[model samples]
Target: MKNIFDKKITNEIIKRIDTLTPETQANWGKMSVSQMFAHCCVTYEMIYTEKHPKPNGFVKMMLKLFVKNKVVSESSYPKNGRTAPQFIISDEREFGTEKKRLVDYIIKTQELGEQYFDGKESHSFGKLSSTEWNNSFYKHLDHHLTQFGV
Candidate 1:
């Protein structure tokens, strides 16, 4: 998996994000480009803000048991995978606002670097290693950006 803390990879990812606009349509999923951007931002929002509640112990246990591997592994996500309730963006979002939020999150994450996240607690999976964090961040962004043919 690519290191999300690396500047070069983050720049490339940002470049991919720059390719999107309000009119961009998904090649597969139902979300508009702006909704997709908002959806992508939800992960970072969970990480850096208190917007979403942390999963309860039972849900955390279930996530670690069943969802952690797929999320934090190097493997790519399957197309049309089910989204968590917190990640479903139903209302329309301004494209510029969502994109800027996402880019800022990426920059903040990269600035913090891998060591800063080495043993950080995740909302659903408890503490994760830096590499696991990188996989989850990079892979999810890649999946959604690619979904829009960016």
Candidate 2:
């Protein structure tokens, strides 16, 4: 897995995102480019905003037990993998707005850098080491970017 905290890798990922446009079509999956961009934003939103509700104790336990490893691992996601409820963006979104928001979030994360995320408590998955944070962030973006063939 590429380290998102690396400046070069971050720029590469941003370049890939730049390749997407309002008319971009997924090679698979139902999300329009706008919806996909919004979906991707959910990850950053979990970190930088309080929009989503935190999981309760039992739900958090379940996520830690069954989902944390898959999310933070170095492995790539399987196609059509099950997403959490918060990550499902069913409505149409304004493509340019969502794209700009996603890019802004990426730039913000890069600016904050790894120190801000090292040993950070994730919204659902508890405290994550810096490597876990990097893997989770980079892999999801990479997967979705590849989904749109960007």
Candidate 3:
């Protein structure tokens, strides 16, 4: 997996993001480009903001057990995989707004870098090593960006 903390990789990712436009259509899946941007933002929001609720004990355990490895591993996600309820964006979104927000979030994460995330406690999955954090962050962005053919 590419390192999110690496400025070069992050810049490349941003370059891909810049290639998107309001009219960009997904090569696969159901999301519009703006919805995909918002969906990607959800991961960063879970990390940097308190807006989303943390899961309950049982839910957290389930996420940790069944979903953690898939999320944090350096593996590509299967196309059209199921997503968490919180990640669903059914309403319309402003393309410019979501695009800027996603870019800002990416820049913020890159500035914070890996050491800050090493052994950091995630909202649902407890503490993660830097590699796990990088895998989770980079893989998701890569998956969606590729999905949109960026």
RMSD score of candidate 2 (Å):
0.8
The total of clashing pairs for model 3 equals 0
**Residues 20-49 of candidate 1: C-alpha lDDT, one tens digit per residue:** 878888999899988988998999999989
Candidate 3: misplaced stretches above 4 Å? none
Model 1 worst lDDT run, 10 consecutive residues: 18-27
How well is each residue in 37-81 modelled by candidate 2, as lDDT tens digits?
999999999988999999999999999999999999998999899
lDDT of 3: 0.94
Q: Report the Cα lDDT for residue 92, model 2.
A: 96
Stretches of candidate 2 exceeding 4 Å from the true structure: none
Q: How far is candidate 3 from the true structure (C-alpha RMSD, Å)?
A: 0.6
Taking all chains together, the TM-score of candidate 2 against the true structure is 0.97
In model 2, where is the ten-residue run with the lowest total lDDT? 105-114
Task: Report the C-alpha displacement of residue 38, candidate 1, in angstroms.
Answer: 0.7
Clashing pairs in 2: none
Report lDDT per candidate: 0.93, 0.92, 0.94
Which candidate leads the pack in lDDT?
A: 3
